[model samples]
Target: MNRRIVLSGTGLVSAYGSGVAPYWDGLCSGRGALGPARRFADAPGYRGEPVGEVPEFDPRGEPRKSAYARAALAEAQRSARLPVLPPGALVILVGQAPAPEGGGQLDGEEWELFGPSAELRPDGAAVLHLSHACASAAFAVALARTALAAGAAPLVAVVGASVLNRYEYASMDVVRAVARTAARPFDVDRDGISLGEGGGAVILETADRARERGLRADLTVAGAACRVGGKLPAASDPGAVTDCLRTALAEAGADRLDHVHAHATGTAQGDTAELAAVTAIAAELDTPEVPVTSHKGAIGHLLHISAVPALAAAALSLRTRIVPPTPGLTTPEPADRVHHPRAETPYPGLRVAAVNSFGFGGNNATVVLRRD
Candidate 1:
């Protein structure tokens, strides 16, 4: 179905802070989170600079032991502030793998070894795990929306989060090898992305339900599309990205994009290919100046959790009409998409914007968010 109604409210914790306010503030200002790399001190061959570290989260003292997923859920519930919400909403949790999965497998370890390390909540509700590479969060969002649309559930709590893992360095190295200086999407010097840890919680419900409950939201999830094309076979990059964008736009009733919050990971191949897709899509529009920016410099790529912060940032841009700057970008050109956020939004009434996320191998997902 093209219409899966958007309800309301969201909660997020990322490299910036444990709340949405701080994260939004940093997301909109073109902030840079690149700092000394300290997560993988014992590992070698991980000589990368600057990482986006989420503010300290000590769950051992005072409060209690809080897993990343649990903390995310709590913050989400607190932020949603939704009253009288459906109690049977399905909980879709992404990144449920063990801590060791990310740290590179030890000798003789199997798939189960790479799964989540946290103990399951004794009272955990019906939870579905999404293990999609970078597109995990968006995948959850799609499934949740579909569940709501199909009347299978009244609401769905979409949570995407990950703890600090040793493989972060391994992943960062893959990104760093491609990108060193900064996360400059479309830039000539574009390399790869920086790894960052993040947690996001979103409550998706029906419009009828939201109104009945008096829930308020800043935007609506007009529609979303996903394309798959693992790199193993022929690896069709352009084909996959274009199909996803086209389908998502068609479903959103949006042919023209006002602003595009890209999955600009700074990797030469990824950025260049994404730019190709962007330019192609933009070419079909009258306003091709949908200023784009990749927030990797501000907060390293949080694989499963990347889209939340980026999508949140896009909502702010559409609200304020300012496209944020690409932190490490000095020169903005054809190949460069990094830009600055104007003090006051130029177009205060911008409506629809696009957020792109493509994962390893070739998982492409594009979401269209319209101001409510």
Candidate 2:
């Protein structure tokens, strides 16, 4: 049986600022936030490239990842405005673990931070940490949907965070994954992704549960599905992504999808593969071409936690019925089936939208959201 889950509220901290408002405004305004990595310029083996760093975030307090998680959680709880939840509610953190040598543990610290947000004892609460690479947040949402459907928890909070630091930057640079210039997704001359720091949180509950409390949802989690590529290491298979999207849309009972929030991060293979998958979906459905938008061009890739802000922007788009542009996309690749909006575009009165997130090791997740 399919259960209906609803999105109650959302919170975020991004390179644009510390709130969802700024993040959404930046997306709608089509302004890129990437700049020089001043702190890393003088460091050993510095690549002297641009990256997105969350302003005022200090890297010394490694465990302070909880700070970002907690701030977003508190704001989400406040925005939810629902009745007090049961003591056994669940909290899920979707993020990358600081290297063991970095002397940081994100799961425990995030739980400690999110625990206070609930009105009940922390001991009985269920806390789960998910590390599925870039698809982490999408997987987190899928888990939350399952928990709510099973009645295992009346409320669930999913938080994701990934901060850029010298260690990780150097690692990506060594592999030529870091762009030497700017972060430009889907551009002909795009080199690679610009690492960005920050995170986002979302509050969710079953639709029936929300109605029981006289609350209305901002968006509904129509459905979510994920798949793993059977290909070689650290690469995604377009076939896997296509299968994932088909299952996700079927799960959502959607025949007409209005927008696609792609996971394009300026990598040649990643962007091309994702666009191919999307184009296939369109051709199979025989629907009009889909307008796609990727936040990475403007916000930079947040690694394990990119889906957080992606979902936040998706929710805003669903409510507003507008698709934000791909900041640096000038030429449409793989034909016009995948529409890249260079400016804010209005939807054709459709309510369903899809958000795709792909991770290393061939992990791909697609979520279908509906507004109504």
lDDT of 1 by residue, 1-372 (tens): 333467366666677877777876776666776665564445554555556666676645311112445566666666556543355667776763534423464432232124333332223345677766778778778778778888887678776665455554565465444345546545566566666666777777777666665555547788899777754321137667767777888888986777778887776666656666667777766554566776776777777768777777777777677666766665544543223343224666578888888786577788888876
Per-prediction TM-score: 0.84, 0.89
TM-score, structure 1 vs. true: 0.84
Residue pairs clashing in model 2 are none
Candidate 2 CA-lDDT value: 0.76
- All models: lDDT? 0.65, 0.76
Top of the candidates by TM-score: 2
Where in model 1 is the C-alpha error above 4 Å?
1-4, 61-66, 83-85, 96-124, 171-178, 230-236, 333-345
Model 2, C-alpha of 304: deviation from truth (Å): 1.0
Superposition-based RMSD of candidate 2 using all C-alpha atoms, in angstroms? 4.1
Q: What number of clashing residue pairs does each candidate have, in the order they appear?
A: 17, 0
lDDT of 1: 0.65
For model 2, how does the per-residue alpha-carbon lDDT over 210-234 read when each residue is reduced to its tens digit?
Answer: 6666666648998899776647345
